[model samples]
Target: MLHIEDLSYETGGRTLVDAVTLHAAPGETVGLVGPNGSGKTTLLRCVYGTLKPSAGQVRVDGTVLDGAKERARRIATVPQDGQSAFELTVREVVAMGRSPHKKFWEPDSAADRLLVDEALARVGVTDLAERPFPGLSGGERQRALVARALVQQPRLLVLDEPTNHLDIRYQLEILTLVRELGTTNLLALHDLNLAAYFCDRIHVLRTGAVVASGTPAEVLTPDLLAEVYGVRAEVAVHPATGAPTVTYLPGPRTPHATTAPASRPSAEQKTSAM
Candidate 1:
């Protein structure tokens, strides 16, 4: 349901995202897995309308994605961090997702409230519904943001590190919840294991370009891991879930081969990409 073609984002003579192209079919969870500064977040921002691409196009459900209002109705994004200029209750924050479907001066309807409550419950943030958004813990804030995206009833969900501050339990819960949602999901994830388990297809990025793209089994090989992440890892299929499982190995690489140098972006670059 989401298609990005030859996407590129450049800033200050540096190319953060370079000629990247990928897609997420309806009800499929497509993952972008890469190390920091590899342009995963930059590509996501370009797709979700947070950043305009220097080149390429983003299309949703066969049509080109344009305009903020229409984009909000079709695509909902859960950024790595949530922010607000003014204090808003959790419920109120989620209720804002429905604004795209309403007139500028229109108030929330009874149906909108129900959707907000349902979304809150779905993300397990019902109790925080009355709390201030900024006062909550990072994980709580992340879940609340997901609830807000859910309330939007978006056709495609773009989540950039949705599990960033979440614990193991919440990590599993959030990814599981997203998997079960059955929406077209485009996720930028740091956890290769989680991406292998949850995503139908995986795309690996390196130095602002797509280095590899395929199913988890095809992309998560030990050689690819070492080449992209500069880490030694053992990849195998799980017996229970039938998904690829990654077991990272410690120690340096062999003397004959040198590990790939990771591209490290600054904090400001990361924030702007997000």
Candidate 2:
């Protein structure tokens, strides 16, 4: 399991993330949802070891992350924007994930190649394996990146906005693929409906803290939506799937007078309005 205890991050005397704690167990998928600037990405960064927490510990399998390189190897991350500077083919990019398993200056072996191919196939990007990395579309590139992470064979996979630039089909495709992998996953997502449908549990962050953590049915109430997002919405179960569905309503509108000119007849006003 991946465990975070009292995690916090500060920069320039301002706290970006407060004392927060969360966890993801093996074979579980946890979704993180919040409004913009709520420190969802920051908390994920801490999980992937990209950023150090100012006042907490990130532990994997009972080992503190700071002192555990092996534990770090068990964690893999896919960030929001999938950009790479290497002028390599998709196969080469996916093959790179095996570096964590190799010794310094070691060359890629046959086992590594097989794993890379498997990972590419797993993400449904095997057909584009020979294409140049920079030539792929946003959705294809995202899949390639995920394939790279899969090649690492991590116990915990952390993704930040994995579906940010994708279409609806790709969004479902990616999350479904992740779910099928059956690895421990922690994903930061903006689409509430997707979270409600795909996540086994969810952590709702608001202003650098986790305000709620539970199953979708327990946490995604209309009151929580209004309190956290400042929007009025109707929450109901999907007719067929029985999953939670949220329908947003427009905010209160200003009252306007419907006064007609003296020259214009009242009948004209009634007909024109209709």
Candidate 3:
């Protein structure tokens, strides 16, 4: 449903994204996994039309994405940054998602309001509908933005760290909700464990390049983790769901062999010496 071909972006003589190519099939959730400053967000920005690519093209359903309105109608993005500029009711904020489906200054129809309410409810933010946006907590703001993205009803959904500031429960909830929507989803996630659990396929990015791409069981290995992230780790499957889990190993490594004590002192001898 979405295609990014040799997408590269650079500024000030430094490449933020370099020749990255990826796609999200219809009804599939593909994850972009990388550490901070690895060009995940910049690549996503190029895909979402926030920034133009220096040497490639972004296509939706076979046609190149060229403008804002058509792109909005086809792709919905929940950015990593969620700071609101103006004070607006939560409902109003979500209602803005409907603008693409309407003409200029055309009032929202009953269907739009219904979709907004349903989206808010789905994201578990219905009670905050009447509240002011700026007053919301960080997690609440993320949920609010997710609600807006849902209401947008685009064919492709792109999220840059959708779980930012969310608690563990909401982190799972937001990704699960996106999965249930069954749309073509491309999201940048920092948590490899979460990526393993939720994404059908994962793409690992290092610096500005794609280092690996495959299913969790295929891509996530101790060696790859060490190579890409410089972390000593072990990968195991969850007992319940069979998803991969990462266990990081910190501190210095244990010696392969250790010397044994020459002789053990008896408790009575130690007591007498003391």
* Candidate lDDT values, in order: 0.86, 0.81, 0.85
For candidate 3, write residues 1-274 as lDDT tens digits. Answer: 8888898999999998989998888998999998778999999998888898899899999999767999999999999867777989999999999988899999999899999999999999999999999999999989999999999999999999999999999998899889879789999999988888788789999889999998877788777877788777777765545567777789543322212222223324423432
Better of 2 and 3 by TM-score: 3
Q: Model 3, which residues run further than 4 Å from truth?
A: 252-274
Model 3: lowest-lDDT 10 consecutive positions: 255-264
lDDT of 1 by residue, 1-274 (tens): 8889888999999999999989889998899999998998889888889899999999999888679999999999999999877799999999999989999989999999999989999989999999999999999999999999999999999999999899998998888788778789999999988887778789999999999998887788778888889888777656555567788878984222223212222324423432
Question: Which candidate's lDDT is highest?
Answer: 1
Against the true structure, what is each candidate's TM-score? 0.91, 0.88, 0.91
Which is the better candidate, 1 or 3, if ranked by lDDT? 1
Between candidates 1 and 2, the one scoring higher on TM-score is 1
lDDT of each residue in 112-230, candidate 2, tens digit only: 98999888988889899999998888888888989999998888899998997788887888887787787899999999988877777889999999999987777777778878888
How many angstroms is residue 209 displaced in model 1 relative to the true structure, after the best TM-score fit? 0.3
Query: What is the overall TM-score of model 1 with all chains considered together?
Result: 0.91
How many Å off is the CA of 124 in candidate 1? Answer: 0.8
Q: For candidate 3, what is the lDDT?
A: 0.85
- Candidates sorted by lDDT, best first: 1, 3, 2
